[model samples]
Target: MKKSVFLACLVCFVSVLQAQNFPILGKVVDSTSGQALSKASVFCQNTTFGTITNNEGLFYMNLPNGGYDLVISYTGYEKKLLRISNTQPQKDTLLFVLAPQDNSMAEVAVVASNEVADGWNKYGKFFSDNFIGTTPNAAHCTILNPEALRFFYTKKRNRLRVTAKEDITIINNALGYSIRYQLDSFSYDYNTKISQFTGYPLFEEMDTTEDVKKTWVSNRAKTYLGSRLHFMRSMYDSIITDEGFTVEKMNDDPKSTKGSNIENLYDSSFYFVDSSGVSVGWDGRYRIGYRKVLPDKKFLQEFRLPANASVQVTLLDIADGFVIEQNGYFYEQYDVINSGYWAWKKLAELLPYNYEYE
Candidate 1:
């Protein structure tokens, strides 16, 4: 998914409030040898649910009721993601097979010849701003392993691409968490001025004092309000108005802000709800405006917008439609793309699927 694109089965919205326990008993193995891969990392992307395989390549995790991209990773092997949900038919156990990293394929795809020798130095800040974000919380976040990242520039296309050899460790001091991100794909298009970074992130809570925890809670609360997760949860519970969100339809012109109000978000033509997942979309581009709070001044300053900007607005378009789950986890997620605000809140402001939402 690009910035104005997900088309994102690399979703960012996460978590559940009151939910049931769903168990995932899993095993990871080398696809070629059929040998168990011990110590393999098993995690639900964007959530606190994660663990490592035992000597037998077996791992177990209990998830709060919702959707998740279950990520499995081992060094020297390719990463795997299984889109899962609690509402689907329950399975007592699951198996994952990972192939060895194909360096030949990597070379062909990454175009070794076009590699930027001084990539990190040249594109570090740019990648950080676009992927990790430029928000206040982002300032406290740090990528610990720039060495694992590779960069490529396609001058003809005026695009930048970045990939990683291993899971990148990111320390988020502002939110009191350490993030392990398995970047799948990240590309930025100069002409469109859009960037997309798709990755599976596993979050681990940092050891900190109660004072710091309190600050984290406050920061998390601030981050959650008016967020994509908030919006999806609101739609799932049919509380769009109560949550202080306003939806306006935008015309075909991406630049045009003109549109009409959507009195019902669950209109039968554009949406359908069920126990599995909720189908959500609109005819064209739609503007989601958050009225409960003012736009973060830092965001305005980062984007160099007027100081008078008030509402937090997100412009999005869904190709056909996508299925959104209870915790805001959606699939065929890449079908949806957001431009303005939500895309601006990247990895730093992200929270997990099991976050305690008070």
Candidate 2:
């Protein structure tokens, strides 16, 4: 089967499965404005079976008779994840209210900022500068990240290795597929911190010759890493900074003089667009990009920021406050972007208000 044809079949198969049996129905609205979010993606994690919100921000999906993760995600707002294990014969009606990201603690219950106006501006500036054009830490390995993320999605696999850094190659025996995300080279602009990434189409050579093979891979890639890439770009374009960034430093330092070699994924020597600043101390400001893997709900991994940068972190939970049942069902897991999930590790060392700036 051809790659393109395979992917299409894969999409249809997942869609059919999601639509089987009974379906859940609901609308998504902005918590702040009470407005509907149209074209929003409402789907089950690990499966392509899902629907997009209409003009009214309404969506529906059919699920098997088991526990499943219902994820609602849209741009410019936080993502929502809900677990539904429904035995009800009637359609389950669900509603979601997405809150605007709190730019400063003064704007929310966490009163860290003394001047709401100034702090909000600082927040806005941070986003506007860093997120205006491209995204941060995004130019490298668009292909391999998908498989690593898929391990989390399918929950069927455990270990994942990117056999080739130049290409994202994965061996998934359970899925009956071997996937490859080949890339052109990686380049970056140190000033902007925007990594320009280019890639070849996703390919899957499977034991079975099915038409949906490619589409399945494509859909999965887009659903996971592709969406992340898009979000990363959005964040970079929206980030604002006082220092602003430019591609000033360029190096292929195989050593990756920085703390981690992950940064080496991109051509260190090439100049790319940038926006965020290097946080010099507990006083510096930044708009950080962060995402937590679910199930474990622990801070498993993170994209690093300048070390010792005074930072503020926000936890976007499955409802506003759906307490994670693990960890003694703590109200929520509080992880910092710069600090990974260890924000509470040394909370006493940072300021109380949750604001980095004085």
Query: Which is the leading candidate under TM-score?
Result: 1
The reply for model 1, stretches above 4 Å from the true place, is 1-19, 108-111
- Per-candidate RMSD, Å: 9.6, 22.2
How do the residues 1-358 of candidate 1 rate in per-residue lDDT, one tens digit apiece?
2654653323432223224657789889999999999999888889888889999999988777889988888888878888888888877778899999877876686664477989999999999998999999999999999999988899999999999877899999988899988888899999998898888888999988899999988888888899988888888788998999999988888777798889778788878887887877554688899999999998898789999988999988878777878888777777788888998899888988677666
Clash pairs, model 1 backbone: 6-334, 7-334, 7-335, 8-333, 8-334, 9-333, 9-334, 15-353
Off by over 4 Å in 2: 1-20, 88-92, 103-358
Please give the TM-score that candidate 1 achieves against the real structure: 0.89
What C-alpha lDDT, on a 0 to 100 scale, does residue 176 get in candidate 2? 30
Worst 10 residues of 2 by lDDT: 347-356
lDDT of 2: 0.38
